[model samples]
Target chain A: MSRQLIIKGSLRRARFTLDLDLDVDLSKPLGILGATGAGKTTLLRVIAGLERDFSGRVEFCGEVWHDGDHFDRVPTHQRGLGVVFQDGRLLPGRTVESNLAFAQQRARNVNAAVSYEALTEALDLNHLLSEPAEVLSGGERQRVALARALLARPRLLLLDEPLAANDADHRQQLIGYLAEWLPAEGIPLVYVSHAAHELAQLTRQLIVLERGSVTAQGETHVLLEAQSEAIDSVARPVAAVVMSTDVEHSTATLQLDDDVAEAVLPGERVLLQRELTEDSGLGPALQPQSDENEG
Target chain B: MSGDLQAVWLTALLAATTTLLLVPLASPLAWWLARSTSPSRSVIEAVVAMPLVLPPTVLGFYLLVMLNPESAVGSLWIELTGDSLTFSFSGLVIASIIYSLPFMVQPLQAAFRAVPESVLEAAATLGAPPRDRWLNVVLPMAKRGYLTGCVLTFAHTVGEFGVVLMMGGNIPGETRVLSIAIYEHVETLNYDAAHVLALGLLGFSFLSLWLVYRYAGHRFEVVRG
Candidate 1:
């Protein structure tokens, strides 16, 4: 239960330096929302032990992995981090099954919560196992990559804009699939994305990064209202209540500021219910009673 | 006639030995050449490709001097094996390996270079060590380069005349390779025998190279360093 991640580091390069001092609770999924050059990917890489040119002390789950100058940093392979890069980064020469099996073979600890059978089935990769990784479509490759990373039984999963490479339809499908499965898996995740809606679909708590620094860190709804409005010019955040749900028709009725809007979407009713129902135990605490509603 | 056949067999043996030794020897060098960003990378690469730029006689001269009984390498060989390093089958193999070094390394380096870093990083994150990643991921992805390096090494060693002549003199059943035999045949005015040997070498070279270029060479043509 003590899944605390403390990172204090200063990564210096020729033209840029990212100084971070963060203490994040890793029991729930944490979203990292940032625009390009915000050092979102670099933060993930530093935690995953892929970027080592930084001076830092990182302690996760009460174990110190980096101690600034004296400690011998744990190498990337030994860090037990499941990283799903934005590019999918599947081994081109291996078949999809081989790629998964490669991770399975190296899994040091098999978390009972995440099994190979469940992951393969959940990712729907049974039929595409024999196909070469290079030949898979963008969506299929990401699925296989996600499955492969899970099969490694990592202690912490790091996803860097995984849906950025997919088409809109594939992105929606993937997001829905992740929204359903992420809470059930019980593995801590640091999901990095530039889109607020995409991160909102997975986690409510988020840290907003800007120019290699944290500008805001709190619940998604409040922080987005303050931070995102200043950065994003084209899109504004909207608040609405689900008025009614049509399960058979896969539709939902929302009351936004006295304006009624009906949306036809797949699984929209169920998604809205999950978002609104506090009984689900996975949804964030949404209280509209507080005047401040401060993050 | 029997001498010519023996020369043919010796040439095959020398080429085979050089190719077999160079595959493992050149692979690490090729990988380093392909991936290393160290300051010594250019220097190491120049040394590897020295055989291609320098005349064969120059290489032959240095190798001949180095293999002298009084030289360090020659003395080390003498201490280990109690035999001279020059004018022997072992000497021919060493000379051929050096003479055909670039042929083995250049193609393999290019192949290793073509492997994307992301794929290797994925392997690393999957708990594979550097050696395992090279063997499992890199070696398979660069299979064409390995094939090309092996074929070229074997063919180049078989066809070498200058370094073999200078370093491993025509000692029958010892260093008398096919090229040397052909040279002797021509010097002795045995045009008929020389024609046969020359034609055989020409035919084998063309076929092996044609087959490599037809199959694996296309992969190298587009993606090369």
Candidate 2:
């Protein structure tokens, strides 16, 4: 897959200094995982052209948005990228329909085509179109925000803990929609979150950040396998996908590390320890063919 | 007694004119003061709010000296418009705008401040330019502030006496407004007409403020929520 976004910059601030040299593929969803204050949000801001106090270069699809030598920086609006902030950030004065309309207008201004009607319908927002954004519930607001951003027809989508406000049911439904929608639409997604389960559900590739630095970058499973020695005793759990659920036996089968095992299913994605346990029946004893235990 | 109509009309005219000019002038300044982190922002803010504390006559005196025919600004005004700046309706309008500047700027600044930075960032990321965001997001959210500012500035300008009297004096049909007219009536011992004009102004002010507080107060409640 071709690289869609390349950002190399050094941002100096009083709180922290972030030195980033990141190249992201356009084909797969990239997950940004970091602890609180690890510069995850700052990284998104820099890439989206929101933070311009940095000296470096940002190239998107062969066009350079910023160059340190020339002091050239494109503003966020012209970057053709959609962002969903943690607060939802819906315009309080506008109705839900009007908010979507404004994004549609922007898409048209940029010569990008977006179907607001289809998007609103898909997001189940047709019934709430006339309601003012201030009255929207947290889940409803996030859905509207997501739909509004998608209606802008951005080439890349940047999400900064966008669903943190949503309840579990809503978050799951929205995540399921995104998992299906993003891949089908072929939009490059850069999802940032402190929640392991969120990143696990959404992305195959992971960029693990710590103290304003990238500590690991590779496939999600591989990075988790290497994560323990990479950082001492920070057992960031790896995600296990549920393959099948046997309701009769009250045990679900999980697929992790090329090994199938029995486990209880509380959700589509569940966190699993690298050292397997007997309750899940996913110990190394059950996986003799796997080389993950070698090194 | 016939002059009461002219005073009423002139007061309305002055207030309307000043409000119209001040709205456009104060909007950008208030927005900048709310959002700017430049070191000079505090300086500009202090300057804008100086009129709120300074005696109106002091402000009027400085304006009088500045607008006199011999000063740089006064000479420029003469060369451009071929008229004296002081003792004219134009001079009164200028003094009123300066005197009422804080009434307009403070409210607008507060309203603009209430708009969260995240909303503007979302607007930018959604492809709205600065102007578009202000028009679509900032303007709508701050509507109550605009209304409050305009009403306060108009009411304040209508009730002003010292600045108008010192800078423009009483030139009937030209510089004489309701406040100056009422003062003149009191000075000449025409208590009946004085009481009439004073009561009329009192009633008008009470109504405008009541209406504004009633409507704009609710908007603030909504904003806070």
Best by DockQ: 2
lDDT of candidate 2 over A50-147, digit per residue (tens): 78687898888888888875456778888887898877888887788888887877883344333566677777799999888889987788889899
lDDT of 1 by residue, A201-294 (tens): 7877899888888888998777766653333333333565556655444445656677876654332322332323321221222123111221
Residue ranges of candidate 1 with Cα displaced over 4 Å: A68-71, A114-117, A228-295, B217-225
Candidate 2 local lDDT, residue B190: 98
Best by TM-score: 2
Tens-digit per-residue lDDT, B93-200, candidate 2: 999999999999999999999999888989999999999989878998898999999999999999988898888999888788988888898999999999999998
lDDT for predicted candidate 2 compared with the true structure = 0.80
lDDT of each: 0.79, 0.80
Q: What residue runs in model 2 are displaced by over 4 Å at the alpha carbon?
A: A1-3, A69-71, A108-118, A225-269, A272-295, B220-225
User: How high is the lDDT of residue A155 in model 1?
Assistant: 83
